[model samples]
Target: MAFNPPPKMTAMAAAAGTYKANLSALQLLMRGLYGGAYIAIGAALCTVCSTGVAAHLGPGIGKLIGGAVFPVGLIAIVITGVELFTGDCMLVPLAAMMKKINFGMVLKNWICVYIGNLIGSIWYAYLMAVGPLVSGHADGMLAVNAFGITAINIAVAKTLTYKAVGAAGMWSCFMKAIGCNFLVNIAILLAICADNVVGKFFGIWFPIMAFVSSGFEHCVANMYFLPAGIFLNHWHPETTARIGGLLQHFGGLTWGDMWLWNELPATIGNIFGGFFFIGAMYYFFYRKEVPKG
Candidate 1:
């Protein structure tokens, strides 16, 4: 497969940004829903596949397994033409910088897509809570399974651990969020560079795997991950007793904790990371070379 050169790829990225800028609020919202659901599918897969992997293989291997499967969501989004908020953080801003769209349009896109993504993520979380995360017993009651426990553990780690250390913890989460989008935009750039399906697949895969394996924070993914755990914990309050660490220390996951601890900081950091770190930097490097419309 052929690869586009850097200058050409830069143009392609900007062009993509312009295309997204023209989408209607309803279109953006509907696509955003799909984007959120697709990412949840990947997150659920990672949770289920990585169960007990740390015990048998190792923690590193466990992370690798989760990371490897997690890219499927982004892959689906890219192939199916859905709107993902994290990706739009770069794409929409890049178009504005290129003068193809205005700041107002960019803000509109972000607002609609962000809301859509949150709704979609929560919707998937409900499905998991009622489905694979639970098991039916002889009594016809469903109980949280090992995967559900893992989800709760992940949620607590993402939220309470950061809450534990105060400002320092928030700063840590912010920095991780920055790192995550830096790689995420890089994956998008690579996808734009590739001319074929296989090329785009591999292009998008590695950086995403690296981000997930390295434990960087992603706002949209957390939208799903945090809620799924919260749902499980709410339905199976006994699971709270099962979790020994930050979950118990914090009195379990709450919506406020989810936003205050991880989501809010993560969203801000993601904007900076994707907008400035990737979008602005790329525009600065390629502005003169970008083709005039």
Candidate 2:
């Protein structure tokens, strides 16, 4: 629980290093796309599964199930390939400004990665909703079918209550969210700079655990998880009277209600949380000499 600030880059060093990542424009674009796809998928799975555990087993056990495992996606996002818009967009420009990279190049990286991430999320969301893999399991309370019933589970809804306490209006709520996500980005980057796996895992775990425990919103995850779960949950009909319980047992309001109320605000929070507040603030403080990590 001690909080350590992420290392800073000096303005002169930031300008001098200017390593072009050795990746060409096309490569950078692909890296961005890949990073976005991985992160989006990771977020969706972590959220849906974690929330499902909570809903089925009760809060304590759910938290334990969600907490105990390491999501290797964190490593995948970094090692498996790609410049995550959530992270690289934040770091690259800072590096360029610090003299570690060129401003135009970093901006190019940000634009390509950000757009690619959006496309990937939309694709992932669509597949998750209409895919045959889920349709087969939706018919039965099948074990292999967890993803079918899991879209809207306790994962995000409880997070709503947690957020409402913070949402004293957007500014206060987003302020808290920004601080939390800032720390998360720092932890993630530091983990990468770490020399060993244990160092890396602990580095990643610290921020991730805090973000989860504190219940901050991750925008991209919401993009995939919320929509996917809601779409799957919508198969039920209140008019049929048999209603498949999407209306009543889906905690009364159904997935649609959860999306409108919870997802929207949380997303706004995530943007304010990770991008504007955290990213922008760090950019402001950036000395422009050291590498971001």
Candidate 3:
């Protein structure tokens, strides 16, 4: 069979969760780092592909292009068995609900994975800022290429624009993040349902495409996106100064602003979206149906 029934899938998720919890601290962090870098690869691809696309096509079509390509990272993670914090937000908790792991274990995994993801994301962001984004120019001579400018626009939109909106912006970011992980966890579940490689590919692809096209916020991806932009601001101030449109709103983006406005709120929202909306809901609904060990 190419698919598992709902109850069977639920049981598999619990088992997978248990396995994740059993991993040693070093194992979890290492896998988490891989996962983060993988996600950054997809994000960077999206930025590069979508740059200047809106002018050629339309805004909606450009977003669709980005969304279509963004799932490569998650597909790689799922197939290769790396740890992603957003995915863990659901998986570890589902294990706890199944009585296969404890809350402490869940917290430990979350902390380790989150830290690993941050380190990995920032490392990749530096590579991107200095490498492809700037075309390997020296620090002082760095000129923001089109892709680099696009990255700055993204970071500024995610952070400063939200900061400008005050409480409403924070709430908006939270809601978008919630929507993002909700679809992401569903994609994970769908991947679990498939029994073959092709099945898994399609299962992971569509939901991810939808979330990105819908303009939802994803914290793991943003860890790279925001820092890449911040690095550009510092390395290519002249390039930023030349841009006008939305760049005017982004006076000076600080690391603190990145965390305060976007990443922190997005992380909180992702936890709820994955843990409660998908993980807990699916666990409870299928609990009675899950087979006994």
Every candidate's lDDT: 0.93, 0.52, 0.90
As for TM-score, the candidate ahead, 1 or 2, is 1
Which ranking of candidates, highest lDDT first? 1, 3, 2
Taking all chains together, each candidate's TM-score versus the true structure is 0.98, 0.65, 0.96
Write down the worst ten-residue block by lDDT for model 2: 8-17
Go through the candidates in order and give the C-alpha RMSD of each one to the true structure: 0.9, 6.2, 1.7
lDDT (Cα, tens digit) per residue for candidate 3, span 1-293: 49998999999998988998889999999889988998998899999999988998999999999999999999999999999999988888999999999999999899888888888888899999988897645655657788998898899889988898899999999999999999999999999999998999999999999999899999999999999999998776775557664455556678998999999899999999999999999998999999888
Candidate 3 regions with alpha-carbon error over 4 angstroms: 136-140, 245-250
C-alpha RMSD (angstroms) for model 2? 6.2
Clashing pairs in 3: none
Give lDDT tens digits, candidate 2, residues 174-258.
4455655575566555664565666666777667666655555554545555555555545432222332333343343344444
The numbered model that scores best in lDDT is 1
Residues 107-226, model 1: lDDT tens digits = 999999999999999999999989999999999899999998888888988999999999999999999999999999999999999999999999999999999999999999999999
Ranking by TM-score: 1, 3, 2
lDDT against true structure, model 1 = 0.93
Q: How many Å off is the CA of 53 in candidate 3?
A: 1.1
Candidate 1, poorest ten consecutive residues by summed lDDT: 243-252
CA displacement after TM-score superposition, residue 60 of candidate 2 (Å):
4.4
